[model samples]
Target: MSRFGPVKIVYSDRFLLHDTGGGDHPETAARLEVIWRSLKKGPLAGNIEILEPRQVDRGLLLSVHTEDYIFRFEEACLSGMEMLGHPDNRICYESYNVALLSAGASQTGIDFLEKGQAPSRVFCCIRPPGHHSEAALALGFCFLNNVAIAAKYWQQQYGRQRVFILDFDAHHGNGIQEIFDEDPDVFYVSIHEHPTFSFPGTGYEEDRGSGAGDGYTMNIALPPGSSDAEVLKAMEDKVAGAIEEFQPDCIIAAAGFDAHEYDDMSGLAYSTRLYGHIGRHLSAWADIYCDGRLVSILEGGYSLDALGPSVEIYLGGLCLEA
Candidate 1:
């Protein structure tokens, strides 16, 4: 059952059909389009605002990534070369701007929260998801750390002492964890499959925060066959419990649909209903602790059919009490 009501959803047509080097690309605009088109059939569709996508300036990216990294990423886009490890995830020349815009939508969502907008909740449906891209490398079809930069922006701009990042991606958000692993003020929590069999593999329970950031970073590695019930329990009992203790001013969700049973990427079996339940839980947490400031950034989910219904369930759950 859901508890929150009428969350203001924001999206862009640019996100719905942006081209990222086409042809079997995992992170294609069709992914966003399917979700958008499907959601329009539901009652929650009326509340969504499909706005034009905007560009993210280098200054905002500089906050989280080094200038060298950004330049290299742009060069890769221009050169039409796959990044070192991900030969298949490279973008075309035009894709550089698209990636930045997608990231900008995330930053804009944060901006809306800072401005005290209605719903005080935003979900960036654009991608080239940024959880796996490291400080310099653009792996996993990701270029910049969108959610990380937004979280850091909140901390720097609002003087938020504590920021909680709840990443539920099937794969660990290695880039985000790496960027804030040593920062006490930022708490990175992920409930992902153990990295051993996963790509970019690093989020272990023992990978807790370092030095001043100790005990703040927590990872709950689910086995490949973990079910939806386990996921809910981990969130309600473990993840939520930790957040309540930390009392963060804001919550950033690395909301990935890849765990969907129908998704091609991972073996985690979760129904769309479970994603709704998760979204509702996160919304409740935001209402109680963070003054309802929660921003969800899309990560990975390749199945078009599952992706649309999954997002619809999540947004509907956030907006309609059940």
Candidate 2:
């Protein structure tokens, strides 16, 4: 009864090679481990497919990131620097390579969705999360703007212009907004905790993009302690109408789980079940606007115990419409 084809998860164990200095690092490799383990035994055990991701092509990486920045990042990792730009952006000698693989995961999904086969959702459960990364700067533990790169690939490779991105992470996707702020082709909408109380502090309602892309960027910030009700209301009232008018050819979700009450990474108090609602919203929207051609790239979700269950529930809801 799947509305689309089977759900595919683009992942690679080699992603674990990008060491984050280990210990209590929030962006640990264990994040992916738990999700992988949970999915194997979780309700959707037999219902999903797991596939390895190819390293992103250099051209694809250059589309969103600057040449100088990419080279600087590569040098930092190769030179044995413990971190890149900041303490949060930890790295290992192999991190540069691992990050490329992480960024490439979504493109592999896009390739599947673009094929003439029936449409299905792809979840890129990659690590060293990418939404926080800017073109030339690394912030909040992200090195490459994975979602933005995939959005670019969707347009360039498949000619699917007008890519719509929905980011529901607890923290706003500053990198994603900034990268495509002036590009009318990509519409970036984010629902995150207010900037006043969040890290990186960029997504604000007043900053509605610039130039020809003005009004394309929408930032909806829920106050602290926000729960499912506030989020769903905003989606129905604001997000949905804008997306309908945009009529995107493809959809990319910056799916983050730190907003869950248990995660404590954000003040927003979304429950684990809230993710399913989020997933259902994306699933319905994908079916309606993009023929179920939706891809979700992992963003932030650090709660060791909660991240796994939250992701499983989200994936289940993503496919529930079938």
Candidate 3:
């Protein structure tokens, strides 16, 4: 096994303050709690370092979201508005600042990797989960496109122009794909449930990138009830080939666990162990092409019982060599 730097988890308790309004919301703060508790006591217990996020300037959000949208979302939260565009997007008074903190986790991670800090793997446990957030619209409980902003920040701030984003969320990242649909500098790749049978319904294999980014975007849609085998094949062959061809300078992962067999959010039936495999693949990829630089942002994963163990195993795979 190849050795690497320690793993750092950029997080803040304030992230839990972004309440999903009320009543059995799947995107609850408890998601972070369980994962936090598990990391403290599970197999990899005390093996990782958890750091609070930095004070990220709100203007950095403009790298991905429109200025009008940035102001509108903040106004809605502070003005006591219940939901933004959809009922699925329930918010509380603290959501605006909390979302900034969520996005800040990634910014903190970028600072470490870009500055050649000690940590090689940084995972941001954030909420108001992005990937569905658009330039000026909010969808699927997302407020800001966190991963997209990180990609832009890596490009504009640190000059890591070729950013390879691997999203293994149960649902396709419509907002992420749309944000970089025509930009070749950032490559967005996603593997999720077939749009015909999933929420938001956008990722189609035929929907290749347009214009300069003609072939950068790749959508690997799995049929309902598809299991780990299908996903592994796609990753080993298709995803590996794509990353090889692109040769990215950095790698970002939208790591969502809702695709697990125990989670009811999607029709896909992935086992908890599948996540470990994914982490190993991504870790190896980062080592090979990015000098062990990998930043993963959490997106979705509701089954509280399964989330802890799944995340732990994935983390184990991540720092396996370290």
All predictions: root-mean-square deviation over Cα? 2.4, 1.1, 1.5
Between the candidate structures 1 and 2, which one is better when assessed by lDDT? 2
Better of 1 and 3 by TM-score: 3
Task: Give all candidates' CA lDDT scores.
Answer: 0.78, 0.90, 0.88
Candidate 2 vs. true structure, TM-score: 0.98
Pairs of residues at least 3 apart in sequence or in different chains that clash in candidate 2: none
lDDT of 1 by residue, 55-143 (tens): 77677678788888788778876886645346656666666777788777765777777775455557888777889877777778788
Residue-pair clash count for candidate 1: 1
Q: Candidate 1 regions off by >4 Å?
A: 1-7, 16-18, 51-53, 82-85
Best by lDDT: 2
Encode model 2's per-residue lDDT on 1-322: one tens digit a residue: 3765567999889988989987878998899998988888988888888777999999999989999999999999999999987888889999999999999998889998787366677899998898889899999999999999999999999899999999999999999999989989999999999999998788999988899899899999889999999999999999999999999998999999999898878998998898998899888998899888799999999998889999999998898874
| Number of colliding residue pairs in each model | 1, 0, 0
lDDT of 3 by residue, 291-316 (tens): 87789999999999888888887877
TM values, all candidates: 0.92, 0.98, 0.97
Single out the weakest 10-residue window by summed lDDT for candidate 3. 1-10
> To one decimal, what is the Cα RMSD in angstroms of model 1 from the true structure?
2.4
